[model samples]
Each structure stands twice: as structure tokens, then as C-alpha cells.
Target chain A: MVNQQRFGLSLVALSCLVLTACDHNDNDEPAPMPPADVSYSYEVTVQNLTQGQPLSPVGVALHGDAVMWETGMPASEALEVLAEGGDNSDFIAVEGVLASATGAAPIGPGSSETVTVTVVNEPDTFISIATMLVNTNDAFAGITGHGLSELEVGQTMMMVLPVLDAGTEANSEAAGTIPGPADGGEGYNAERDDADLVSFHPGVVSADDGLMMSALTSAHRFDNPAVKLTITRTE
Target chain B: MKLKQLTSIMVATGLTALSGFSQAAELEITVQNLTRGIYFTPILITAHSPDQQLFNVGEAASTELQAMAEGGDISGLETAVDALSADTVANPAGGLLMPTAATTTTLSTMDGNTALSIVAMMLPTNDGFIGLNSWMIPEAPGTYTVYLNAYDAGTEANDEIRGGGAPGAPGLPVPPPLEDLVGNGGSGVTSEMTNATVHIHPGNLGDDEAAGGMSDISNTVQRWLNPVAMVTVTVSE
Candidate 1:
């Protein structure tokens, strides 16, 4: 009688297990899936290497495939704004920008600033940074669309930046036109003057060099490689 | 598969032995002037032993190098390199390599010649020249590219005036083509070479006035930054 009673209890337990399994299959809810993994961040440090020219507030952006500027090509409207007036608003809001960061203040000559920007995406991303030499008419220095796919964790790359002219404005060195402390004048205008294609800057000819109406002096002059940029992949 | 691997090894060994037997190499070199306004004086391309240097930064220049940097004379440097049994080509362009121009030359380097150097004076300046210091030539047969920068010999003052081309001269040499471009009758810029050793050039301080100004160079035209020339070398197997 005891063995029969135990057999009956075992049958009841099997029924309960079969019923639970059927209930689970009949439910509409799906199984729990693994979590999605996607994210990236970079730390960029820009050092002003000039003697007297202070760089404007930097504009940093992360994108997938678009370039901010190209050598021997025309500067886009976003680049023109940043190069002329030290305003990075248009550049930060550019299309394809995954993330953007702007320095709180202008980086002075011989000083450095670090900016951090993060994006939640795959590893196939690029970073671009730009800033104007606020003392000059249209001179700016930065890099565009540097690939970050191979930047391993804790890896850093150092690049020397060459000065470029935004071709949207003339390098007239006229008074009341420069936007930096050298002139405190107008910044960006829609007018397209000079060569329309971006090219290496031919340096500024200050008033000391006979640009009589120029707000700049000999001290504002600069040379190639006006900025040093170091980028490190932190995460 | 085993036979294929053995054949590959044998070919590699044969090639290495052939390279060891052939000690001479033929090199085809092309140099491009990338600037828009600057003029490169007659260039001297030399392939010498590993011990020689055409120019050294932060060091005092030899008299031969000074002559080429201050003036557009390569005779001194040519003679010096020749004394070392170096393979050299002088003035491949036959004259000034104009702005945005290119010149090419071919040289056969004998055994023990392993390094290469090129030098050319930049006109409309006092002591500026495009320099490629001693660089090792790779033993592997391939093409290589090198960018050259302008260097100041620190031997003469950069007065930026128009005068003569002789060694130890006071001012720039007005070549025929550049005479029309350079200004005239300018007061001197300076008469001092502050750092009397090879250093980066403190670029030209030009004036706008074409005639009768503080500088014979046009501020808008005569200035340049680093990397004035691009050199391409093709090594024959």
C-alpha cells in the first residue's frame, strides 16, 4: 500500500511538470535575449604651439564617414563659420555628427586643453577637430576624419597640424574684420572672396609688414605647424 | 604541397645570393618643387658612403655647405662629395627648378654607397636651402618618398636685399626669372645671424613695396613654410 501511494505521488509530480511546460509554451512573451554592446569614447588634447596667436574655442566632432574639410578643396559652410568667427555652433550641429564637444574657452598660445567626447556606436568611427587662429583673417588648424578603428585601448597618436585658409574670406588683414582679440571685429560673413578652394595658409602680413590698415602687428605672425594634437582612446 | 614549398625556399635563396653578388644598384630619382612662388637653385643629389653627411641640424656647417646655402654654388659641395668617391648628379634640371616644377635624375651607386642626400639653395634669401640630410637607402628594391625642408645654414644674415651670389655675400641672388618677381632698392632687414648653427629658418620678412622698401622680397610672395620639396627614389633590383 505504501509503494502504490508513492507511485501515485510521482505521477502527480510528472503531471504538474508537464502542465507547467505547456503553460510556458502557450504564453506570448518571448525569451530573454543577451544585452546589446555598443559604445566608444575618445580624449583629445590640443596644444597651441604658436608664439602669440591664441586658438579659438575648439570644435570637436565624431562622425561615421563625412569629412569636415579636405586639402585643395573648398571649405564647407560649417568649416567657414569655425574658421572665421571662432564660432563652433554650426560645426557641432553638422549632419552625421554622432557627438560633439567644444572647449569652454579659447586655448592661448603655448597652452593646452583636453576635450572628451563619447559616442554610443560601433568601432568604425572617425574624429575631427577644428579651430581658428583668432588673430588672423581666415587661418585655421585642425584635422578631419581621422580613422579611429585601429586606435586600441590606451593607444595614443600625436599629429602636428598645418595651418589652412578657409578661402571663404580674404586674408586682407583689414581693421574691424578680424574676430580675435587682435581686432575684436566681425566674424563670419556670407560673402565668398579669394580662392574658393582650401589651401595652406600663406601666413599673415601684419601692419608691420605694410598692411597699413591691418589690426595685427609683427607679433601676430606665425609659421607652419601652429598646433599639436594628441588623441588617446580611453575606452 | 611539399614540393611547392621546397621550390619557394630555393627561389628565395637564389635571389638572396644574387643580391649579394650584385653590389651596384641603379636608382631613378625625381624631385618635385611644390611651392607656388619659391625658386630652387640647381640641385645636387649625391649617394655616398654611410659615414658622410650633407648637412646636420644644430651643428656648424662646413665651408662647402655654407657656400651652397648662402649662395647658389654647388661646386664646393660637389668637389667634397667627389673626393669621397660618391655618385652625384648636379643640376638635373639644367637651371632653376621653378615653382611647381619637377626634375629627375638617375644614378648608379657602387658597393659601399648606402646613404643619399640632396641639397639646393632657395633663391631670394640669404642662407636658406632645401636640405635632405643623410638618409639610409634601403637594401630592398622598392620605391621610397621623402619630403625635404628648408634649413638656415646660420652663416649669413637674412637681410633680404638684392645683391650678389658669391659665397659670404651680403644679399640674395637675382636670377633672370626671379628678378622680375623680387623687389628692388630695399633697406636691409637685418645683418645678424643670431644662432650661428644650422637651425630652422626664421622665414623671410618681406615688404609689400616692389621698389624702395625695407625688403626686396614681397611679403605676399616670397615666404614659405616647411616641406618645400618631395623626392621619389626607385631602386632597381
Candidate 2:
């Protein structure tokens, strides 16, 4: 774990050096032109904080001033697809996106993945990333459009994020409903049978706990802060 | 540019003058229950010297803290903080703080009071309480936000059955709001607390059967993850 974190940090530093060199040369050639390409490279590392839940393919996006999802509001079709099916294509295709990146594969329990997203000409952009606990119905963890403008060079911030329910699907935990290895079931159905507004997930009710038809067990249950996210600005 | 510099200088001077006159500070605090279905008993909020602590992880709970954790009583903790000359605000909600509700209180710190602590029992549990232990108050004047997690006192069994509310109570206290929500008439979950010290709560093991199950708490509606409450504090110089 320690070695992985160190390698991730070094990659971020190398990217920043490249971006800084590009910005310095652009300053001399600009005249009433577009904004300088003050690029920023960010390394986002996520750790699964759950006992048995394995997260789906992670989605990372950089947007200007818009949010992907909000509480007490109807979820966008892009968000609904990702929440139900763990697909990142629709979510990454959202408008006003400055840059985006997706993890190569799903992250398992006690595992960590470091993704590097580089946005050009948008150093003051807001970063948002999310991944679903594929064992549950619609639980996802990520940060919204948190301001990254004040992040100094080589500075890092660590935070633990709470799980949120997309409110597009009910947390039934039934057979053939979950998309992870726990059930090997279908993903991304276009239906809004549950609460439509986003809210905090109340966790799964496994068979050991009382849901007789639930495919999940006590071992598949989880709690808050299902993921630990660390953001570092290299340039 | 000159006006900007002058404004900065005057602001610094005013801050210095205000710090000199006040030996202590008056704080306005607000705590919000962010969960959907948890109940917080009367809360115990205190500002004390750095030497004192209400509770600590991996340490045994004091008799006063145990009383507040096992049951919903705060008088013992209130008196303990009073003896230490700590500023305290007891039962700010006047009653139980229901789910998705908020409460506010005010506490004035003494000259040496530099640390803050808050504790409150969670309903439908034998020995669980929301805890914030001895956080150092910042010297700078600003608004700060802190999140609190549920801690097990480890002094009693979490049978989850409806029973007494006293300090040494064996089962959960079925308050009015939770009376219809929690289950009833079930065999106990466990009689032993493996770690006999304050620790992160393993969370409630609620069952699905409403009338008869191993636990009186409903598995779907009663369980919570960490960070059940949020505390916002505004400091004045």
C-alpha cells in the first residue's frame, strides 16, 4: 500500500512538470488570445472501506460550474444510468465537462486505485468522481464540484466520503438485481421505481438480517464511508 | 492600493484589541441529526480544560460516561463537568432530537477552557452514544464543522430487546418515536462485549421480523453507519 501511494505521487509530479513547461512557453506567444493553457494534473486514489462490497468501474470527471447530481432534485439520465448499471460512458458524456477519465476495472475490497486526470486550460476547474458498490442496489460514493482553485502546488487533501443512493432504484438486494460478483446480475435498467430524489443510503437488509429473498448475506453488508478519496494537485 | 493596505492594518489592530480584553469566549453551537431514523437522547456538551476528557477510544468509560451511554441520563456528566469549572450546555433539544432534526445551544468558555466534548445516547440501543472527545478549540475566530460517530461504551450487552432505561439497563429503551418502528420479543444477539472499552460501535444487528425476531430493532430502518450527527461551532474572539 505504501509503495503504491508513493508511485502515484511521483506520476502526478512528472505530469505537473510537463504542464508548467507548456504554460511558460505559451505566455510569450499570446496576444489578445485565448486563456493560457494552465493545465493541472490530479491524482485521485480511492480505497474501499467496506468489508465485502467491491466497487464498480470508477468514474472521474472535471466540470466547470455544473453539478452532476444534487439532493432533492431529479437525477439526470446520465446519473441514473451509472447508478443502476455502473456504466461511465453516459456520465462522462455530460455537457460542460472539461476533462474526464475512467478506471480500467472494478476495485475490490481492501483494494486501492489511483487514477490520473489531466485537464488543459482549466486549472481552476472543479473535480467530481464516483463509483458504485456493485453489491448494493444504487449506492455510490464520490465528491461533488468541490472547489480546487486554492490547491497549491504539491498540496494534497484527504477525505472520507459517505455513500449516497441515487433514488432511481430501490435497495431490494434481490437475486439478479445487483451487478457485482456477488450476484453476477444485470446492470442499468431504465426505470424509476423508488424514491426519485437523492438521499443517504440506509444500507442493505441481508438474508441474515431478515430479508428472506435477498441474495445478499451478512458478509455483504456495509456501512458509511464506503470509500476514502484523496485528491492531490501536481501543478 | 493605499486604501487596501490601510484597511488590512485597521482590521489587524481591531483583532488584537479584542483578544486582549476577553479572558474567555462565548460560543453559539448547533448540532444536526442527519440520519433518517435515529433518535438522540438529551445531549451533553461541554467546554473544559485540556487536562479533562469525557471519553477516549480504547479506554474504559468512567461511571458518569457509562451512565450517559447506557441510558439517556446526563445529570452525572453534567455534574462532573461542573466540578471541573467547564462550560456546559445540557439537553439543548429539550427532549429527544429526532431524525432529520436540529438543535442549538450557547456556552461561554472560562479562561482556561480550551477543549470541547459532546455526548448523547442513541435510542434503541443498550450502550451506544454519539461522541466528540476533547477537540482542541481553535484560537482563530471562524466557523468550524465537525462530524461525530457512534461509539459503544462496552459496559452492557446490546441485546436489542425492549427493556429498561437506567444506567445498568440490559436492553434498549423503546422511546415513543421508536415504539412502532422497532421489533419485539426476540432472543438476544449477544451477552458479551469483546472489548470492554470505548470503541467504534459495530452497529446494530436489527432483524426483519417486526413482532418476533432476534432483535427488537428493524434491520431496514434502525441501522446507521458512522457519522450520525454534525456539529457546527462559531468562535468569537
Candidate 3:
């Protein structure tokens, strides 16, 4: 708490120094006072809880109250691409996103990643996070349209998230389908083969467990509560 | 040791009620089986003292728990909790809770019963069950959602073959509906109980064949991800 106060004081001091420097250099016409911009910063940390499935790069977004996805509803094209291929490029750029951040690389099982996002002058901010379980056909884990407006600075929120099947692609476990290292196959395909609506993932049926065409093995099996997500308001 | 905590909670409740500060809570609970192929036998939802746990992870399963986890029997558990004057609703869904099905029941808990626990056996596996053990009821009246994972009772082996439903049974109990879905005999999955204490279940290893696989359970149909159950609790004002 003391450190935060000290940091705020130093920022004020630095701004004062900048204003003084401008006054001395441009005495003829003083620089116009910049608009007061208050920044809200959030640090989002995601931990992979699965035994084998590696999480794709985490995508964090600050947006309005619109839900990114819902149960029984078809996944957006951005979500479908990310859930199928573990490519979150379009997901982080979805409409209505005010600010976003993406993890540098895939988070291995039992690993965690932290991404910090900052938005200026956006007080009523809502957070959404999305990431794919790279070993599955189109399985993803995330929370959509969670309100963060009431989260006071320095407060922390934690949640254990459940996995969701994007339903855009079939959980075939077939060769040349999964994009994880276990398969080294293709990622997102535009075709909607399976149930197109999002729902809770039923889990992987690996080849060791009787799926004859599956490229996955028993090690790829996982249960619910696949990720532990933590959010902290830094500023 | 845990029993002492329960006594203290009871005493505190007595004092609060005598001081004219009764905190009776009314709760409406729903349990949904989210698995794709697993079936839940007779669910047991109870609201007891804070320290009274229906089941604890990493601990030994009680005899009552063994009976319920092995077979679809809840009479022993019901009797045990009834002795504590707990608020319980056993088998809200008449019988088996099929895949993707749900059961709802309302419980008006007396003062001091502020913890909730729910348990049910998952069929097609030996001693695999879903559990929510002693979650403290929030003081604020609001709706809360909790997801549950599959647990092993640690009393029986997970040999996925059709066998008796009795405690210490050798194989899985193939109910009438599951008889056709479950396969015939080859050999048992395994006769070993690696973890004698309750733990997270290492899911079933089903095979493709029906009449002549290593086990009877179907691999393609019975597999599930974590969070086999979702419990929604609504605390009323």
C-alpha cells in the first residue's frame, strides 16, 4: 500500500517536472495542458490446471457488457478460430474491445502466464479471457463479460474456470486435426462439423481409451475446472 | 478434533438464538449431471454443521460412503446424518440421474446448519462418485454455482466389468438400462487399489470392443472431462 502511494506521488512529481520543462523551453506560447487521462490497469494471471493439455496464448480484453460467448449459442468467428487452432489473433481484436493483451507463448500444463492490460479513462470496464486447450479439437476455457467496474484498486479476484467446447468442430481426435504437439496437425478449419453451439466439454476420448482413429492417448484426458484465473487491479 | 469444532458452532448458535438473533437459512439447491455418458445413482444433499463433512478428500471413506459409492445405496448415509439432525434431501431425482439431467430440491435449514454437501455415485465405474464436501453457506443471500469433480472412494478397484453392487464388490454394477450399453466380459480392468485413501479419480480406460475387450465400459461413450456435476445453490432472503 505504501509503495502504491509512493508510486502515485512520483508520477505526479514527474508530470510537474515535464510541465516546468515545457514552460522554460516554450515561454512565447506555453504548451496546452494535456487532457487529464486516468489509466486503469489490470494484471490477469492464468494457470493451466490440466495434466497434459497445453493452453494457447492467453487473450485478455476489456470491453462493454456484451457477452463474448454463451452456452447454447454459436461461437463467433473470432472465437471459433481461436478455439480450433489456438490462434488468438482475431480473438484479441474482436469488436468492442477497448484494450487487449496476449501471452507471448503457449502455457504448458501446470504453468501460468500473466498479462497486464491498461486502458485510459475507461472506468466501467468489463473483462473477458479466452484460451484454447491445444490438444482438443475445439475445446476452450474462459470467462465472458464479467463485470470489473466494482473491483477496487489493489483488490484481487480469483476463479477456477471450466472448459467449454466451441462446438464449431467435431471432437474427432482424428489424425491431422488437433494442433497440439501430441498431434502436430492442423488447427482451425472453417467448416462447422459438430454441434455449432457452445457447451461444456465432455472430455477427450483418446486412442488408448478406445477411439480407433484418435491421435491422442490416455495422457491427453482431462477433467473440469481446467484453469485457475486470477485478476488484480494494479491501478 | 473436527467434532470439537462442531460442538463450539452448536453452542454459538444456541447463544445467538437465545439472544433473539436467529439465522435460519432457506436454500434451494439444484444438482445437474454434466457428463456425457455417466449416470448418477441416488443423490444425497445435506446441510449440516460447518465441521461435519460428508466426505473429505485424502481421507478414508466411511462405511456409509463405501456403500453409497460402490452401490446406489444412500440409506446408511441418510441414517448417519439424520442422527445429527441435519437438513437433508436424498434422491431428489426419483432414481438414476441420467447424463445431462438435473434434480432440484428446497431445504429449510435450522440455525447452525450452515454447510452444504452433496454426493452421488457415477455408474459404469467401480466406486467413482461426484462430491461437494462441506461448502460453507454464504451469509449473503445470493445464487452461487459450484462445479464438482469425480472422486474415487478408494474402497474398490475400478475394474470396468459387470459385477455385484455390494460393498467390497469386485466389479461395476451394470444396472438394467446400462446392461445393453455396457459390453460383455473379457477380463477386469485391474484388481489393484493403488490409492486406499479417497482421491481424484483417474478416469476409466475403456476399450472399443463390446463382447471381447479388456473391460465392459465403452471408451468412446463414457469418457468425461473434469467437473462432472454442477451444483447451483440459491440462498433466500
Candidate 4:
């Protein structure tokens, strides 16, 4: 009871000190000021949940309802560049993005990386995060147009994301086709040969499973809920 | 016609149609193919009691469930559910539900039917079907989404070849649309049954060969990951 009373008294004293400071400022005939612009910042942490596939540098953005990718729809050039290759340069340059950030390096299996995005004045209502599996043809995992506007400061949101096939490139899993540590070969190609629309990734069928030309083995096979992503509003 | 008949009978006998206090619910159900390449045969959707499971894992499938999973036919299963007084919507899509395609239907369930179940055989497989075994319908009105996995009924061998769809058949049923899509002239993948009970499918082992491989299914075209289907149910007030 004594500690509670003392804490209450200190709070009253602190308010009084602030009031005195405001009174001193009032003597200078201060003009009414408009509301200050606040910079909203969010930190997104992505953990790779695949066994052998390493995740590319996670690309994150805060934007409007304009989504990065849609299922059963052709992927935009920006998304193709990121999903086919491990490149996020074009994706971050997409228009209407309030703020964007990319991880420094690839996140391996069972590893995590945190990327921070900040926007000033604009309401960052939508959050989009995307990254490639790097071992497959065009498999990527992330969420797009996820609402974060209702998120308050210091609040965090968590979601387990499923893998999506970009459908820009065929999942041949051939030698010199994959871009990850397994193949260490080609990245993005302009040709749209496979299904031209994005959908859930029909997992990698390795060479062990009758895919003779597949550069991948059974070790590279992956399933749904490939990555665990957590978002937090820092400021 | 059956739903209308039930309504008319209740109207003619006008003495509180429900057996006791009403436990019925109106539902809007939507099923979508989440796979990139696969076709769902005529879907069998139903609302039944809590204890009436469609198919249970680690248990031998009922003959009615076996027929639906082996062939694309839901007649046997439909008849069995009718005997239980369950409300059902058979083949809402009218035909095959293609990859990424969705089908929606409304179900006005009877009293005591508080659980929902749906089953459909996926083409290109012998006894594999997408199964949602008796999910409890929520009392509150809201939208719910559930992902469904492919199950092997253990009634037939997963030969992955063209054959008749009768019960105890050795291969898959190829309808007219999938006639060209599925290849022919292949040796069987496996003739032995390791686990002779309803269980999670180990997925198809398709080969890159088009004509003369172990499995007629193309490795690049027919393989699927877990969660082959997505079901969204909206309980209306």
C-alpha cells in the first residue's frame, strides 16, 4: 500500500513539473501548432522452415491494397524477378510502396532474419512479404496485402505462410536451372513456359521419385507452411 | 427434389417438424482445388450427427466409402447417409472440379445433424480422395476455412494406370476429359499394399516418361503436395 501511494504521488509531481514547463512556454505567446508527422516503423522477422531449401533475402513492403501477387493470375515482372531469381531490387522499386526493406543475405534452413520498414505520414495499412526458396524453379513463400493498419505500437502478428509457385518458370529441377546452393546455376529467365498463373506449389518431385532429369533429390522436397513470419510495429 | 419433398411432408403434417428443439443450421459451403494439376470427381457433401464419421484414419473404409474413393461414384455413400437421415448435397460442381476451380452450395441441415463431411475422389489416383471427416458445425454464424488432405482408401492398389473404377479395381478411373491428359501403356507403380487401411496418402510417384514409365502419371504434371483441397463453410443465421 505504501509503495502504491508513493508511486501515485510521483506521478502527480511529474504532471505538475510538465504543467510548470508549459506555463513558462505560454508566457512567450506561443502560436497554435498543427499535429506533427509521425513515422511508423515495422519489423518483420521470417524464419525458414524448409529442410534443405534456403530462403532468399526476404523482401518486405508497406503499401495500399495493390497486392504483390495473386493466385491464378500472371505474376508481375517485379514478382517474377524476385521469385525466379533471388533479386528483390525491382520488387522494392514497385510504385505506391510507402516503405520497403530487404534482408542482407539468404536465410538458410532453420534460420531467421529481421527486416525493418518505415514510412512517414502515410498510413501503412497493407504489409507484403515475399522470398524465394532458391532451390526450386519459381517457388516462393510470403503474405501479401495483409492488414496491419489496425496494429498498434509494440503489437506483433504471427502467421505461418504456405509456398506458392510463381508459374513464371517451369519446375524442371534440371541441372543448371536452380539458383540455390544445391545447383548454384541460373536464376531468372524471361520465358514463361510452365503454367502462366500462380498457384500453390506442387512440391518438388526429386530425381529419386522418377524425375530423371531433376537436379533436386528427395532432400529438396518441401510442403506447405514453408516459412514462419512475425510482424511487429516498432514505432 | 428430395429437399422439396421433405419440406412438403413437414407442411402437410404441420405439427412442429423438428423431432425436438431445433438444432439445424443453414450453411453456405465452398470447396476449392488448391492443387496445380488435379481434378476432383463429383463431390459428396453432407451434414450428419457428431458420431457419424465419413472415414476414419487407421480404420478400414466402409464399402460405401470404398466405392466413392475407388470410383468417382457417390451413389453408395449417398444412400448410406440417407438412411441416417442426414442432409446432403451431391455433386455441387455437376462435374469435375478442375485445378484452382471452386464450387459453392447451400445446405439446410436437419435437426441433430450438427457435423459436416465432404469427400471426393481425385482423378489420376486409384483410391486417393480428399476427405473431411465429420467437422463439428459451429453454432455461431461466421465463415470458416479448412484445408483437406488426400487419403488412400486401401480398397484398391495405387497402380496409377488406366483401368475400370469398380470396387477392388486395380487402377484409376479416367473420365472423358482426363482421357488425353492421362497417359497409357505403363507398368504399375506398386501392386502390394503396405498399410491396408485408410491413411494419409504418400503421394503419387509419377515418372517423367509419357508412355512407358512405371507410373502413367507424369512426374512434371501430376504430382501434388499435402492439402490438395480447401473448404470454406459459412454458417448463416
In the order shown, the candidates' Cα RMSDs to the true structure are: 12.1, 9.7, 6.0, 6.8
Per-residue lDDT tens digits for candidate 1, residues A1-235, read: 9999999999999999999887756557788888786667789999999988999989999998778886546789988988889999999889998899998899999999999988875688888899999998778999989899999889999989878778778777888889999899889997887666666677888888776667899999888789999999888
i-RMS for every candidate (Å) is 3.3, 2.9, 3.1, 1.3
Output the lDDT of residue B104, model 4.
98
How would you encode candidate 2's per-residue C-alpha lDDT over A176-210 as one tens digit per residue?
Answer: 98887789887888888776766666788898877
Which portions of model 4 miss their true places by more than 4 Å? A1-30, A122-124, B1-23
TM-score of each: 0.69, 0.75, 0.75, 0.87
List ranges where model 3 is wrong by over 4 Å: A1-54, A70-78, A89-122, A153-163, A167-170, A189-212, A217-235, B1-22, B34-36, B50-53, B56-64, B79-84, B94-102, B164-170, B175-181, B194-199
Superposed Cα deviation of residue B194, candidate 2 (Å):
5.5
Model 2 CA deviation exceeding 4 Å by range: A1-35, A47-52, A64-81, A88-98, A110-121, A153-170, A184-205, A208-211, A222-225, B1-23, B26-28, B34-36, B57-63, B100-106, B191-197
Looking at model 2, residue B148 earns an lDDT score of 92
Winner by DockQ between candidate 4 and candidate 1: 4
Candidate 3 clashes between residue pairs 3 or more apart in a chain or in different chains: A223-B225, A223-B226, A224-B226, A224-B227
DockQ comparison, 1 vs 3, better candidate: 3
Instruction: Give the alpha-carbon lDDT of every model.
Output: 0.85, 0.84, 0.89, 0.89
lDDT of 2 at A159: 93
DockQ of each: 0.15, 0.21, 0.30, 0.57
